[model samples]
Target: MSESSRWTMPDMAGILSNKIPQDELKPGDHIYSWRNAYLYAHHGIYIGDGMVIHFTRAAGQEIGTGTVLDRFIFSSSPSHPSGSPCPRCGDQSRTEGVISSCLECFLCGGELYLFKYGVSPGVFIAKTRGGTCTIAPSDPPEHVLHRAKFLLQNGFGVYNIFKNNCEDFAIYCKTGLLVFTNVSVGRSGQATSFLAATTAIVSSPLRFLTTGVSGLAAVGFGVYCVSRYVSDIGVRRDVMKIPVERLILCPGPLESEATTITDTSKEKGL
Candidate 1:
């Protein structure tokens, strides 16, 4: 937590959006919103001009339009009346360029909107400070932005919570490599992890005695799964308990929605 070094989250929050001035946000920096300390629900890349680019599942047709294929949302502050909640905050705006409110995002999944506004409250923003997380060569900031823009131009594709998610997009932009973290969800995920470990342990000898290469391979795979789950579970529990005081925020040009935004907007009609 020193000025010279960057903060690292052992598991969730992956650095906890440690508050810093938004002015410090440069193109290619990662911004995220936490469902809580244990769960980072959204992530995007800052593309300057107060805009962020991130992959989302939210997409639809125009007023008279039908299904559309836009997944990457180019987001910014909404142009709502000053002091009023942003029109795009919930499901209010059907326009393709707004980030949906948390409620809407939770209900129908998220959409990628461009030009609509502000991140959800208590959302955290972060950027790589010194170097890259992996050995992948880090590009210059301009190059990073260009890469992000190029991906956005390609539009969004299928979203997979486990395989392809927001963090994968942001990290790819910054480091030119697709990466996935091992963090999972709450009780259900914990139960699955436990089951995976127990099955691996219980099936080892049986598989070794009864089957051939494929059976042994399954046991090996189980070993890998158990190790991964073991490492992740302890940290996951710790993160859920992290003190709120440890979170960081930036202090610079504040977006208008940052102050007045809430979870109430026009609901999506059937």
Candidate 2:
């Protein structure tokens, strides 16, 4: 594909398979790679120079839920199987919050895939998997790089698998959008997928209408797709554009901070 084609809106096949070679990567690109046998993906911002900045938990604490899931999720940071620090990144396995690592270490033996933004609603739903793309458009590369680098110097608050994770970090860097609802999940598509699956299985209306197992399965899948689509940051109305500096200085939760800022704006009537 030509350079322009690579950046164009992806076709159905391209959307289904979003992999891109390393040579195509540009600064401020959101990239991810599957980890733990495709159980989940680790996401980061490609800020040029073969380095990635991502949010992660400390080693052995990727899953913050403190359940059996932790055993399976595994740390998303760079780790060498031979118990040696990566020559370029230097033992970032235990690093938490926002940190930088070389592209090799970031991939950690996984295949690299580009994250798509500004996708059509049809395309977003057609993707059975969440976290691969979003309907929101990305900001300019310079803005994205600035956010990533700023977070690296400060922090992105704590890492919560459901509300805040690597995917959330990358999404924020790319779009500067943050969920302002305290009860809702963050912008992480992986987290949304898990919730959507549970919602589908437990509360799908199709369960009441369908008698056959196949019918029930079809209903559940439809519910799952709808759940994922509506909860997406791009589609949700509960998000706000917040400056990265404000997030760093806020002493309260992100949602609360956003609310306070909104109220202040209202008082000023600007």
lDDT tens digits, residue span 1-270, model 1: 664344334312423334435566666665554332322235566776666666554332211112232222322222233434454453333333213233223222333221111221112112111111222334567766766676666543344444445544555555443211244422122223344555664656656564677877666665645443433322222222211111112112122222222112213221
Work out the TM-score per prediction: 0.39, 0.89
TM-score of 2: 0.89
In the range 152-269, model 2's lDDT, one tens digit per residue, is 9999988888888899999999999988766658999999998999889688656888789898888899889999999998998768887898778864677676787767877887
Shift of residue 106 alpha carbon in model 2, Å:
0.3
What C-alpha lDDT values do all the predictions have? 0.39, 0.87
Which number leads on lDDT?
A: 2
Q: Per-prediction count of colliding residue pairs? A: 15, 0
